[model samples]
Target: MDIKLLVKLTSRAWALDILAHLHRGVPGRQATLLAATGAGRTAFGASLQHLMALGLVARNPGHGHPLRPEFILTAEGKAAAAKADAILRAAEVSAAGLLRKSWTVPVLALAARPQRFSGFKAGLGAITDRALSTSLQRLEAQDWVAREIDLSERVPFPVYRAVNAGGEISRVAEAAV
Candidate 1:
C-alpha cells in the first residue's frame, strides 16, 4: 500500500512509461503502441521484450507478422502497472510538498533539459550542496532518475535524468495544467 516502496527502485523512466502504457489495458499490438507512444521502433521493441519477460505482457495470438506474433498485457502485468502508477503518484506528491519558494524550482525548471547532479545543484539556488545531493540520490535510488557516470576521467561526474514512470508524471502535470 505504501507508494514509497514502489518508487524506491526501478531501472529507468522508460521502463515505468512502458508499464503505465500497458496498465492502460492490454495493448492489441506493437504498432498500435508505437503509434500511441510515439516511441521509435527500437525503443518500443526493447521495452516490449522487457515487459514480456516480466510477465507484464504476453504474446497474443493474432495478426502480428504472420510468422512472429503480437502481444498484450497479462492480468499480472496489469496489476503490476497499477501498483507502479500508485507508487509514482505518491512520490510526486511527496516531492511537490517538500518544495519551497526557490528550493527545487529550478530543478523542475530543467524539466525540459536532461540534467545532471552538478547542473541541478547549481540551479537549486538556495539549497545546500548536501541537500541537493541527498535529493538527487533519493530520486536516483527510487528509479525516478537515471544515473549515468562518465568514467572517461579518473573522477566521474554522475548525471541524473528523470524517467516517465507509468505516465504518472505526465498525468499529474496535465491534470495540474
Candidate 2:
C-alpha cells in the first residue's frame, strides 16, 4: 500500500464517497451509484475508471449496456473498500468531506507523530492559524486526534497525537504518498 496510491485515491473528487457507497453492498449500477454519491456523470465516470485502473473495481461482464455499465469490487477493491469503510466508521466523518479539505490528511499525518499546535502549523507551511485550529478541532471532535496539555514548562502548551482512527488514516495517507 504505497502512501501515494492512498493519497491519489482520496484526492480525487468523490472517490472516497464512491468507495464507501460500494462498500455498503447495495446497488452497483451506474445510476444507483450516481444517486447515492450525488456525483455527476463526468466525475463518476472518471472515478470508476480510476478505480478500475487500480484494480479496485470492475465492470460486471454483460451486466448492462456498454454505455451504462454495472460495477463490482474486485478482491483487492473489497479489501481497500473495507479499509475505507473502517476509516469512516471510526472517524465518524464522511469520506468525501474528510478528503475534500486541503489540510485534513496532512494534519492527520503530522498528528500521528505527536506535535504541538505550532509544530503542526509550521509543518504545513503557509496555513493560517485559524485553518490549523479548525482542522485539529474537527479531528478531535471525531475522536481521531487526542490533545494533551504539556505542563513541564512554566507555561503549559497543548500537543496533539493521532488516536487509533487517526493512526489508520495516517497509515493510509503515508502509504499513498
- How many residue pairs clash per model? 2, 10
Candidate 2 on 65-172: residue-level lDDT in tens? 898789999897887787666555545455436655656776776676779998977766667999889988988887778999999999999989988667787665
TM-score of each: 0.43, 0.64
Evaluate all candidate structures by whole-model CA lDDT and list the values in order: 0.52, 0.75
Cα RMSD, each candidate: 13.2, 4.9
Q: Judging by TM-score against the true structure, name the best candidate.
A: 2
Off by over 4 Å in 2: 93-96, 106-110, 115-160, 163-177
Lowest lDDT sum, 10 consecutive residues, model 1, at 1-10
Q: Report the lDDT tens digits of candidate 1 across residue range 19-77.
A: 66666764656666677656677766776776676667788765578645776667866
> Which segments of model 1 are wrong by more than 4 Å?
1-9, 87-177
